[model samples]
Target: MTTNQLVEQIKQKKSFLCIGLDVDLNKIPQYLLKEADPIFAFNKAIIDATHHLCVAYKPNTAFYEAYGIKGWQALEKTINYINEKYPEIFTIADAKRGDIGNTSTMYAKAFFEDLAFDSVTVAPYMGKDSVEPFLAFSDKHTIMLALTSNAGAFDFQTKEIDGKEVYKHVLETSKSWKNAQNLMYVVGATKAEYLADIRNIIPDSFLLVPGVGAQGGNLQDVCKYGMNDNVGLLINSSRGIIYASNQDDFAQMAARKAEALQKEMALILG
Candidate 1:
């Protein structure tokens, strides 16, 4: 989807919530096992329950990769379902993939061309060449890793390099790429303080923040520091919403969780 489209959805729904589908077989309700495809079954239920409350859906690729071929098929089915059913909701393949140019192109094709995801999360450790290939796709977005929400992020992202943080450099450098306009970023919600600095570098770019409910990152803090004129933020809540309950009412429980977030977002937007 286009940036204007994304912003429009945020306004129309009074939300910029991106519900993450980080499903795990061990963690899902045992009842779903009776289905022909439990993973897809769980995802369908979650999507049905929370679609109106969210502007985006991100399925972390690791969850599907773990189950091998069946996992991949399930992922394809999930993406197809979302595209056919709710094309307005942005779809992100949270793959965090980056490689040399050639391989990166293939990766881009896999997510953008084949699976038809609206965006893909990419790692910038390999520098611009690795990430630019994904950016080459005009109709899609490249969500580069910025300041992440993990404990290990402090190990390098915040480390000062030439008196500037490594992540700060990544944001600055990424903006100069040929297809920079299509770039979004992954700035963890826990590092809300950095949002001001992040905006200083790229105020207009969308940020896909992934740490809120289960990770304990404050939603208000993120909006306070990160929101722009367009309210450029896609705060994601994975485990807290999708895995809210393992009972038969799991979908409804997930909807309740998403609704609470959307309500807060509505107040923020107002």
Candidate 2:
């Protein structure tokens, strides 16, 4: 989807919430295993129950890749289902892929053409050549990893390069790339303090922020610094929402969790 389209959805829904479909079989309810395709079945239920409460859905590729072919199939089915049923909802393939130009092109094609995701998360370690291939795809977004919330982020992202943090360099340097307008970024909610500095670098670009509920990232703090005139944030809550309950009412409970967030977001927007 186009950036304008995504922004419109956020406005229409009164939310910028992005639900993470990071399904792990071990964590899902045991009853879903009886279905023909447990992964897809679980995803379908969750999507149907909560699609309206949020504006985006992100399925981390690791969850599907771990299960091998079946997992991949389920991932495809889940994306297709969302595209067919709710094309308005932005879809993200949380596959932090980065490689050589030729290889990155293939990865871009896999997610953008074959699977038809609206966006895909990408790593920036390989520099412009690795990321431009994905950015080249029209109407699709390449969300690069910037200041992540993980403990290891300090290992390099925050480390000073010359006089500036590596992530600051990444954000500033990325804007000069071809089709940079299509670029979004992954800024973990745990590092909400960094959002202000991040916005100063790229105030208009969207930010896909994970690490909210489960990781204890404060939503209010994220909005306080990260929000723009367009409300440029996709706050994701995975385990906190999807795993709200593992019982038969899992989908309902998930909706409740999503609704709570959406309500909070509505107040923020107002």
Candidate 3:
């Protein structure tokens, strides 16, 4: 989806919430295992239940890749179901992939053409050559990792490079790449304090922020500093919403969790 389309979805839904479909078989309800494809079954239920409460669904590729071929099939089915049923909802393949130029092109084709994801998360370590290939795809977004929420982010992201933080440098330098308008970023909600500085670098670029509920990132603080005129944030809540309950009523409970966040977003938008 284009940036305008995404912004419209946020306005229409009164939400910028992106639900993470990071399904863990062990954590899902035991009953789902009876289904032929438990992963897809679980995802379908959650998507059906909570589709309207949020604007996006991000399925981290690791969850499906871990299960091998069947896992991949499940991931395919889940993305297909969402595209067919809820085309309005943006889909993100959280596959933090990057490689040499030729290799990165294939990765872009895998997610954008074969899998049909609206966006894919990419690592920026390889610099312009690695990321430019993904950005070359028209209407498909390449969300580069910036300041992440994990404890290890301090190892490099925040460290000074040429008198500026590496993450800031990533933001500034990325803006000069070809088709940079299609570039978005991953900024963990846990580092909400840095958002003001982040915005100053790229105020209009959309930020896919994880680490909210489960990681204890304050939603209010994220909005306070990260929000722009277009409400440029996709606040994701994975375990906190999808795993709200592991019982038969799991989907309902997931909806409740999503609704609560959407309500909060509505208030923030107002």
TM-score of predicted model 2? 0.99
What local distance difference test score does each model get?
A: 0.95, 0.96, 0.96
lDDT tens digits, residue span 187-235, model 2: 9999999999999999999999999999989999999999999899999
RMSD value for candidate 2: 0.5
Q: Model 2 clash pairs?
A: none
Off by over 4 Å in 1: none
Q: State how far residue 223 of model 1 sits from its true place (Å).
A: 0.3
Give the alpha carbon lDDT tens digit for every residue of 121-196 in model 3: 9999999999999999988999999999999999999999889999999999999999999999999999999999
lDDT of 1: 0.95
Model 1, span 1-270: residue lDDT tens: 899999999999999999999889998999999999999999999999899999999999999999999899999999999999999999999999999999999999999989999999999999989999998899999999999999999999999999999999999999899899999999999889989989999999999999998888999999999999999999999999988999889999999999999999999999
**What lDDT score goes with residue 262 in model 1?**
99
